[model samples]
Target chain A: MTETSISLQDIVLHFPKQRNIFGIISDFFRKKIRRFTALSGVNLHIKQGEVVGIIGRNGSGKSTLLRVISGIYPPDEGMVHAAGDISLLAGLGTGFSPHQTGRENALLYGSILGHSEEEMLSKLDEIIEFSELGSFIDEPLRTYSAGMKARLGLAVASAIKPNILLIDEVLGVGDPNFREKSKNKILAMVKGASTVVIVSHSFGLMTDVCDRVVLLDRGKIIAEGDPQTSIKAYYDLEE
Target chain B: MGQNGPTTPVLRQIGVKSNPLLAPINTLKEVRSNRFLVRNLIRRDVRGRYRNAALGYAWTVIEPALLASVYWFLFIMLSGNPDEMYAVWVLLGVIVWGSFSKSLNAATNSLTGNVRTMHLVFFPRSIFPVSGVGANIVVTMMSCLIILPLLYIYELPITIHLVWIPIGVLLAGFMALGFGMMMAPLNCVQRDVQHLIRFITRAGFFVSPVMWTAEMAMERGAWGEAALWNPMVLPITMVRHALEGKSVELPDSIVISSLVVSFLIYVVGTMIFSKYERGAVKYL
Candidate 1:
């Protein structure tokens, strides 16, 4: 009954078959190079303020679908219409440079996410606080561990609340304590009425947060229902 | 954060379109909206280059000056002209041609160089190349300052024609951006494209009017006409004309033709870039 916040109609995305220089040169004279279809004829609609979970095996178009909705990967066919600001929390620390300090990379990452530098500056303290990096924020990003880098990325991206937030398998990052903190943060965001989409292999978080779940297998949505039903469907696919 | 009161959802529509004419206008709009990102990127590029070097920013000025001296020495050895004016002339040529060549090469590598950011977030993919052009323009204008000391040393009188220096620099940028927009996408599609760009720019340094004035080439008759085939001839010559404070002896036909070619390249480049950019990611 609620207004649809994001709509996808028969979306399809494909990537050219990888080729070496010799292969490409040969293909130039020969015929067409093959393409690997990542997503094919997928259709779905998400309502405003609803939490949706997408679960799929590796290379089943889970991340690719998220990219499509975020406008990173333009669909080869069909259309994507989203009614609000959308931010995808994949590849955390998007524009980060190892040579730059943690604080500087935070600003750069935030700017890449469409926030102005001044706005990021204002939130720099909050980001540092949430990241718990202490004085290490001034140290170059190369000094940080994988978990530290993930923490810094999450801290900056979550600083600005988006109307629609899509998080990808990033909740498993950082220490167990930080992982719990991030889960609480996402739950808070959902409670705040932000339309949220999550893609994760784990269904425990989905059972706790998602109103409905969509199961994807080899590019198509195979089932959609309550979280319990979709989880059963996913397990059946695995078997 | 979702108060749900008086909310106007921002609509984003994504689909495929075949129109090329609209590419430029769309790019302009994207650039305007992301002006801050462009500015930040340009600043980062300029500052990042000198971050850890002991010489730091001095390298910006010293680099062209050093190249100028080498070329000046070589010209004297080859032509046996000990004229002080020759030193000044070589410096101006080196500065202009260096920036133009670097701009082209930089823009070509721009997209390939920023694959992480390009894939992680969606701004205009065009921003990378455009900022590459911007950073080069900034560096060229700054590097042009070396000309001041050269002029003072040679006691060359500054004239009204000196105004053409900035115009020439900007025109060089425009031309480079056109070529860059066309090449950046392809460079992503094929890694070899970047290597090819490097080779072309290197070879271009000799064939272009960098070492010799268009006037010198013009006196050679057929060689002059052949040299005119390079679009850089006019801008390079224009910068030299500004420094020497001489009338532009270039014929009207060549000037008009160069301008038209530059504009057409820019339009066509954007068209190709916009159409192929989304697909280029597949290769990346």
Candidate 2:
């Protein structure tokens, strides 16, 4: 039997409507809830070293699917199984406090990603070198520009080699040179024997890096197969 | 996709378990596994609190000291000095109340404050409240050091009962943590919960023996017995009794019952938090 790195069976997710105090109290007393489904009847599986790309329009549940696979959001109905440690680079500079120095934020982010302080400290030099923040690493994150923040985020996230790496639109970061460096970093990660699931809007990047691509629309998979075919199908649907 | 090659077991499950008993254990296990994260969070919180302050760490001591002095002046002016030891009594109450309120306030807002981090990664959401409690505990210890000299200056008689202070602090911490855990998740869902907690804690100071003595309540007969149910009463009274070298006025039954209630609150809080933890991010 081929070792499966990640699998999902008929996964579904729903979110309740945002409410004020009055709404919550009423909902509590009425014993009823209204929710909007984000995903439905989603089934997927990845082999140990497969690199899959998920392409979808805005609010099409691409991020939600990654969250479910990473065990952040519980599916309303369905089963999800992911083996090994998974790292999610969802948003820019997650777990980073503006008041904290870059070094401290890196340590904090590393801990949030499940690395011990000592482990992070040992990787500190490499992370700093990779991000190329140089002397500014000691400065508070508030001092960094937008691209600088994204570099630190990417640097800390990529420092540790995760068994499963889930990327959500992080490729659209930094200026040209830094973007090239980050893309290379991602390519190197994909070269390893690790399962990767990436969500992005960049069709060229998806087709270039992903072995396969899945096209999603309105919370359901519409087409999935070779990157070239899926990308074309996605554009055809858009047209 | 239909070629199920010996269906592999999924690493994590999405649905909630029916067994309520297992919830607390699972929550504890999650928190324990993330102890490093919790420690770093606590460190960040404590440092963050005093980050830009000119006085820095001294603010931990100065704030409580200033508060105690203000209460001392107000109470002495209103009711006249009760005894030579009134300052010590007031300082003790201030320390106890400060720890409890600081912890509750921090923990109540913990989830809301860390909403960004919660969305970006997955850890035990309980860690926010738990680390809030830890940060307060560290600050409380620093404040207690300031009070130690006052006790010595007053030449308060030392006794074996002094040991009860730590126990009291510990019980108070657990009670605050329980309340925090219960409120943290709710606060994420409803912004009103934090406001409500603030109101309750503000009103709690008057209801509990923070500025008054338990003897004042004991004089109320049956009302006094009802007052002991507040949970803070026992610990506050214990710390006062320990420092004053007085006999424990709270009966054994009452103490045991209070301990059991605090424990139950903690367990119930964990269960409630775990129940809503996954949903909390959505609300955030």
Candidate 3:
């Protein structure tokens, strides 16, 4: 068996209840503000090269779990151990400035992912080719459509091959042709001994690509099994 | 933390560090390790800011130049007799004060400005504020270039005392970084904190030693001594003194205490930011 790539033990996280200024002031005089739990007592283990899918309704902590595993959010009560470099793909085109050219924004985004400019330059041809942006890469990002921007974001993000890739709802980007191409790239990564964790509402893709699926509800894991079983459980829960 | 290889298991705990006393030291280490990210961010900020502007980077020099000239004119008109060095003095003060206030306000807004990026990836959240200070410092140094021409126009000589200028700039930068780090987290939670900071920095201009020197303040006796405790006084005064090629005239006790206080504030600010930053992100 492959070694465990990600190990979480009883993770718990809470977001402070947001309040207006008046509510906060009144609470200061009367009581402490309350908190809403995002994740509570979540434990999961994934071995190397596994493709794990997380499915849940909105507000069900699907995205929160990915963040916890990637070390974005510090769990309030648990220990998280993961092997190798982790890259999170959430909200593509984040940090992209519309004023910069696609090439410039690509360089900036690469740096955000810990790659140097030289490294990004080396991968520039592949990024532009994969993004299908062609000569348009020289133009300022303000000229790109939303789809073009997301394509550029995905191309740059995928340029660096990470040990663990956590994708959050970004796979459903671009035209169907590009989506298929990106999916193939991810499958190639898994074949190359990388772990993949994806959070998405697209069940058909989840069932087709995932090795295992986990269903979450109200911040707790409710079911875990092969893709078909867990997805069925999710559908039943919704009903 | 990043890993070396796939085989090396990286154990990352998802909560604040257990020891608060070592938090600042650890935060410094984290920031140091991510220096590349900081550098790239600084470049982006510097380049993006000027890319669309008509004057481009020239605005960096023109802004302080215009503000300094207006103040210099007002002072000359008010005092009746013109001090030959007063133009250079006001120029230096305006440049340093511009950097200090921008650093403070930028630091406060740093995290909020980068909230989208902050969530997509994790490095050191402190990098946002650190890079904010850095970008402002780069612009301020560029702004200082305008002062060189004024020195020649005013017919002043460069002296060894001018070495104190960078020191003063850095001291002001460090103090602003500390206060801004503390305010960044608070500003993330309650946006009112930002408006309050804006007001304070605006009021700060009149209270700080920008228009007047510490020598003038010391002449007022105890009130001046107490005013010297404002933390901004020493650095602003240091720059103004260096430009005038005069030795700093503040009491040794006050100087030492203010220096120590700035350092302490930095330490406290780092600790507070590390502790509360995660919580603050939720608010954003």
Candidate 4:
């Protein structure tokens, strides 16, 4: 029996071009909307426990594909099938409020991720320790540096053991030491049975972590194979 | 884990279910699953409102108290003591209206306000309006505490009928939630809906029985009879009747119609909300 953790068949996603408030008001009378296709007729499948790295240039639909797979954006066409609870580490500090302390933000983020308060509280010490914020954990998030915020975000997100994890550009932030620490933490997470899909621009990081690499360009998969071959093809495409 | 090992079920179903009939059931299931998320959102909303204030949660009570006083002065001066306990009546009406207005206002902006988090997380979208209702309910309960002292001071008789006050508040909440669920998604699509609801709610304050009693409307005959059609009329009147221990005659037809309308609004609102909820993030 083949175990497929994630599958997408002919997936298509189109985002209606956003309009300014005034434009929206005028369009209310005009009733016209323009759409931009983010992904079109893309298909992929990942086996259980496979680490797939998605690499693409900016506006190449890398993050959009991750979102579609995570069930954030419903595909305009096609089907997405996945087995297991999925966690998305999209942008840093998506759930954190500037006015809230790091401790409060952790609990809030945990709650948003479907963990109960008691459950989060029980894991509070571990999350704080992993974030390495120390006394700053009690301070409001507005005062934290970008690196500090990224560390906290990654720590809280990885603390929960998801069945499938979708990561997007989160590993590229923070200092070298913390980046290495975060990279190891992610490696440890994927070392388990969890299927992972990471989107990044850094070829070194992608080759370091991914067992397989899928290259996307303008909403289409341009290449797929072992990390070295795909990374080579991606660099070749740049020329 | 092996190829056939049991794993956690899929985190989300990719497409929106096509069956309209099942939308409400799916929404209910989503709510039940995200109950903890809803609770924390309510806490965050209520706490976040007064986070940096010196007075803190005291502002919750102070707001209604201040509103009640203003209404008390204006109405008492205008009518010159139509009823001996008119002050209590106005206070009750104001508090009940407070809950409805607060819920409606909060739920209207709930989705638009949380577009950032909505884009990041994949929980049921209904959590926003539900949490909005939850937050306002907390504020209403806190304000209701003032009634205890007022009850003692006024020497208002506590009959079994007073039990209906909570039921009345709950009904008001349902009405607000229904209206809110209807408007929240629409507001996401159009900024106009937000301004429109604000206007309606402001006008609604005068149109509802917040400042005057049903008896005053009845004194005007046809206008009084027509005011019975407003959804807020029954709940406000019921609360006043419950608190004052007055034997106010509520027509059976009006009571039944009000309840039916509230239920319809709730059912229809949920259906409309479920339809638009999935697409809300797109517009946002």
Candidate 5:
């Protein structure tokens, strides 16, 4: 039996339309709800250590697929499986508190990524050095520029080695130097005996990093296999 | 609790430890990740709120100090011959009850403001509310440190009864965290819940005895007398009584009942928060 690192068979996700203030207050009084699904039916299976990439236009269920696989959103319609622990780093730095210093946030963000205090402490110097945040590390992240924040976030996420790392367009962060560091870190992570599933629109990023690519359109898979073929097929479909 | 949740003989709450949609721990994990997050959050809240160069740490004490002065000006100075004991009562209630209500109110809004984090990662969502209380406690403590010196400067006698302050503060934290957490997932799905918290917390400001005396509350008949039966009222009263060097008078039943209420809130809040915290993220 080929070992599968993560599996999703006929998965579906739905989100309800948001409520305005009036609706929310009424909800408190009435307490009624009905959810809407975002993904109709999706099927995917990733083998161990596979660098599978998911590509699609906006709202094409690429994020939903990754979320379901990483166990963020449970599929209403199908079975999802992972052989071992699964860690998701979907949007780097999204989990950070804005008013906190980067150094302190490193511990909080690191914990969010499943690192214990000791592990976070041990890796603190390494994380700070890797991100090259320097003196700004002691300042609240609200003080950092967007790119600086992204670098800090990515650094924290990468510090914790997840068994099945899920990336969602995080490669397009920071300036040239920081982006290079992030890419190298990603490459190093991919080389480990762990699976990675990335969702990105950048054909170069997907082809350069992914072993194979799956194209998604309108919440369904349009093509799969070689990155070049998938890219060409996606472009053809778009045309 | 799952394999990743804490295994402490005692835990703060379930969702704070594990849930299938979030951290998904079952007790054995005993890893203190969320606690670490809470500590950082509390530290950051205290540090960031005070780090402004103009007033710096004095900012922590300023608001309460201003309120106290204004209150003293109106009630004591205007009336003439104000007792030190009454000032102590006002100080205690102002600090403790204000902190508790603020924590709960702010906690109800924690999940909303951090929607970016809420959408990207899953942990016991209860931690958001807990972080709010934790921050409140840190801020409250810093303010209290400043308040005590003011008491000494003002010539109010310090007593051993001051030791009870920590316990009183803890109970307040538990109460706010319990209620805030119960309302958190609901707030995430419903924005008006935040507004409702504002309305009610303001109402709480008047009813919570923060600015009033327990003797006054007792004089109001069934509703007021009936409330010393309510757990929060007794504690608020106790804080005032303790600060004034009065005997710590609390009915055993009230203590037990308040603890029970706090526990129930923690239980129900965890169950409800876990049921919906993951699902609520999509709405955000």
Candidate 6:
């Protein structure tokens, strides 16, 4: 068989738009809440080893599309096909549980990321040493400073070496030095990892990392093809 | 959609996704039941608690032991039955009930407790109940070590019937585990169940014949028989009788009914849980 990979067809995803809290308690209780459509008729496909950038605004369904593509959420209506174990880190530490220690959470989170226990163990040292937390690895994660936790989370997941990696604004967390390291590690993986989908509002990073760019707006793909053209379309539209 | 409980039927409405690492193990793949994966989840469930606790796991025994003291004090002292073998009776019930109930109570909310993990992890979510049950049973066995010594000090004669304790324990585990697996899926769908089961579990504690014996229920008339209907009472009674070497046969109706009920619950609960399992992750 040919090395075909991920595919998405006419995907529609809706999420509760309104925050369901009673600001005006006396007005109504158990009222219906509004929904915000995140993705509407989104059709895309990525071949094995293709590096794709998904560019959209905050509410433009960019992250939602990535999450759906990551197999985190089944589209409300659509067909999706992804071949190979997909690993996704939606946020800096989205998968880590606060109650668990860094050492244990690594295995727990690593397993979910699709690594077996032996796979995680063999890479555990690199993960910890990269995080540079040293003895703090034993501390309960809730106690870790936000930055420390981010380092730990990023290190463990990067060590996983996923086949298809979905990264969503992960480099937004740390300082310049850490961001450089993060970008280097990610770029290195691009050669080995079969497919990668990165979502960022920053056109610069999109240009730097992705082979092709797809611009999304209000849940629909408005323009897709060249990195520069999509960037021009995104900025010109904003203008 | 669910009828009586939270079950998300995974209807393959469309095409298969390409995930080489985690293709749904349709019939068991090359993996040899990663012993470490199993150990990590279970170890996390166990050491996760004891790691930061001041009392450590000793609280496992101290917990039921403390409850035993209060019950024995109330029954033997206040009830003016100091001569009665109530302490050992309470200890025995505490031991067996401690094992299964700790697991059941933990398992009941295992899904809710690990909502984050469940949403993220792809390994069988059933591992939560299994791990919780396993962890509680370990602690229960440890408490039994304390209870066994106490049993000797109380001069209770050991007998062959105690060999059946493991069987009864296993049955009790099934009963609790079945209920737990069913509740896990339900907790995922309904947000309120976590709070609701708290009072219900407390009520369950009193009616379970844990602190007191079923014999005293006689004065309560039909209420006494009604108490036996509580599914938790039967396994403990069987195990308690077996452990005490009390020559007694359980009523045929109860034995047949409970085993069947436990079996149905176990099978149907697992079915329901797996059904909704995927949907929960989707919604989350």
Best by DockQ: 3
> What ranges in model 6 sit over 4 Å off?
A15-36, A92-102, A135-144, A172-175, A237-239, B1-35, B82-84, B95-105, B118-123, B156-170, B214-223, B245-249, B277-284
Candidate 6, residues B48-143, lDDT tens digits: the string is: 667767899887778877887888887765677654567766876777776766677777777767766544434556666776776776666666
Among these predictions, the greatest lDDT belongs to 1
Of 1 and 5, the candidate ahead on TM-score is 1
Clashing residue pairs in all predictions, respectively, total: 0, 1, 0, 0, 10, 10
User: Which parts of model 2 are misplaced by more than 4 Å?
Assistant: A21-32, B1-18, B157-163, B245-249
Taking all chains together, each candidate's TM-score versus the true structure is 0.92, 0.91, 0.92, 0.91, 0.85, 0.81
Model 3, span B57-165: residue lDDT tens? 9999888778878988888788866566666666777888888889988899998888888778877788888889999899888887776886687676789987788
Residues B193-275, candidate 5, lDDT per residue (tens digit)? Answer: 88998888778766776666657667788887666655566667666666666656666776677778877776666566667
Model 2: what TM-score? 0.91
The C-alpha lDDT values of all candidates are 0.83, 0.80, 0.82, 0.81, 0.71, 0.69
- Ranking of all candidate structures by their DockQ, best first: 3, 1, 4, 2, 5, 6
lDDT, candidate 6, A44-153, per-residue tens? 88776688998877788887676676655667788887766666765555456567789988887666565776778888999988887899898778888877887877
User: 2 or 6: which has the higher TM-score?
Assistant: 2
Q: What is the interface RMSD of candidate 2, in Å?
A: 6.2
User: Which regions in candidate 3 have their CA more than 4 angstroms from the true location?
Assistant: A18-33, A116-122, B1-18, B246-249
| Better by lDDT, candidate 2 or 1 | 1
- For model 1, name the residue pairs that clash: none
Model 6: TM-score, first chain: 0.85
Clashing residue pairs in candidate 4 are none
Count of clashing pairs, candidate 3: 0
Clashing pairs in 3: none
Q: How many angstroms is residue A190 displaced in model 5 relative to the true structure, after the best TM-score fit?
A: 1.3
By lDDT, rank the candidates, best first. Answer: 1, 3, 4, 2, 5, 6
Residue A47 local lDDT, model 2: 81
Q: Candidate 1, which segments miss by more than 4 Å at Cα? A: A18-33, A135-145, B1-4, B8-12, B16-18, B158-161, B245-249
For model 6, what is the alpha-carbon lDDT of residue B225?
Answer: 71
